[model samples]
Target: MMRALCLTGDPVADKLLTDDPFALLTGMLLDQQFAMELAFAGPQKIATRMDGFSITKIAESDIEEFVELCVTKPAIHRYGGSMGRRVHELALHVVENYDGDTEGIWTAGRPKPDGPEVLKRLKALPGFGEQKAKIFLALLGKQRGVQPKGWREAAGAYGDRGSRRSIADVIDAKTLVEVRAFKKAAKAAAKAG
Candidate 1:
């Protein structure tokens, strides 16, 4: 069910995970304290802030004003009281520590430098937590092996009714069967050898 609803594969959303480092980081900053749909709005609001977010502009902006800008929508959908301020601080922190170079986040020596690493880095930012990091990574492609952890428990816990557990109860059931058969065959072949 998750795979089915996500069939077209969410490519545009996937790019947020690894392709464009700056945008991904920006989205992560905006993601804090909002729903999945709302958190994504942070990046969209930022494009007009400068000439394609040239980095210098964000670093130079009066974060207080930028935070006010972040208060407009998605970020404001939930506990939006101070979302603007949060976004402002996040951007400033990025610029201050990374020299506005968002991609430097991947140092090449840590934990395979994969999607999870990206999540780890983003989570390290202020205002970003586990859920924010996971949602941000979800936009990437679900490829980084990052998944919404509470989804299953939420379903059973609240009877979420939306759990699709009925449908996706066993993802790749056929594939699992095939894998088991392959393992059996390989084991037999090895024993015979």
Candidate 2:
């Protein structure tokens, strides 16, 4: 499963590493409605424009500008007429509690809450529901202390609920090791050739 994730270019599946946890949280929030590809593009574009789109920069940004960028340039999530306002709310929420600092927000939320508790807290946010909440928990859990809702159970429950959410089970760590070894040997053989 880990190999499949790495092989697939899905960034969410990629083991994301961040010194600033708020950035991960914010990026995950953008992913709620945005297609994965577009969602991946949003932060990069923002970072390019601001020279570094950190939580502080985003929180300090005028809501009008955030809305404008959300709607027009490098548009990722389509929140209809509601995109700007919703993101404004999210940015403000982060700022109010986190002093507009990415590291601070993550740390405040840190020592990482238990998986279920983390899910509950995130669901309390304005736009999130069970599915979105699960997605964030799953993604963040992979990198942090949280765990993906046991894969089989999440899939069964989500499927019953008609949820499109795909939780992974059986991460094939060995496959990754094997594939990497194969690649190394192939590279060596080619070089020898």
Candidate 3:
């Protein structure tokens, strides 16, 4: 178990994330075009709206109704309709590919799991681009202690223990602020470049 996650300031929602692999995965998937805290809180909001957060349930839900659920008050994402579709697609992928075991995306495979393989799997998932895959790979190591061989190298700079560059390094409100500031600086640098 991940013990604790400070992603959302809400203890209950954060606890749900810690205890549920699917919630953690879904939260990571939602971490775009929205505030980090809101993105992390999304799975809980989805669980409340859907009465459960099962992968198969989400995968089988009606598309229009699921999109409506996402766009309802305290919507799941900024682009709720699209994000909801992505979430549903992600669930279906998990169910179809991993037998509903979200953890398999990171843990299953070769006897000695390699980080690049895990990264490849993450990148294959809906909403997981290269940066997102690396960030989540780093999160698995830095926070959840799910480090397979070569995880740090695979995660690149995001795997640096003390870096405040991404959610992988956020352990408290202070780290959250630091990460936000770091991201702001990086975005500014990109714009200038």
**Measured by C-alpha RMSD in angstroms, how accurate is candidate 1?**
14.0
Residue pairs that clash (backbone atoms under 3 angstroms), model 2: 1-172
* Candidate 2 residue-wise lDDT, 132-176, digit = tens: 666555544443443434432442342232232332121244433
The number of the candidate with the highest TM-score is 3
Stretches of candidate 1 off by over 4 Å are 1-19, 49-51, 72-81, 108-120, 134-193
lDDT of each: 0.48, 0.50, 0.90
Which of 1 and 3 is the better model by TM-score? 3
lDDT of 2: 0.50
The lDDT-based order of candidates, best leading, equals 3, 2, 1
Cα-lDDT of candidate 3: 0.90
Model 3 lowest lDDT segment of ten: 105-114
* Collision count for each candidate, in order: 2, 1, 0
**Cα lDDT, model 1, residue 34:** 42
* CA RMSD per model (angstroms): 14.0, 11.7, 1.2
Quote the lDDT for 135 in model 3.
94
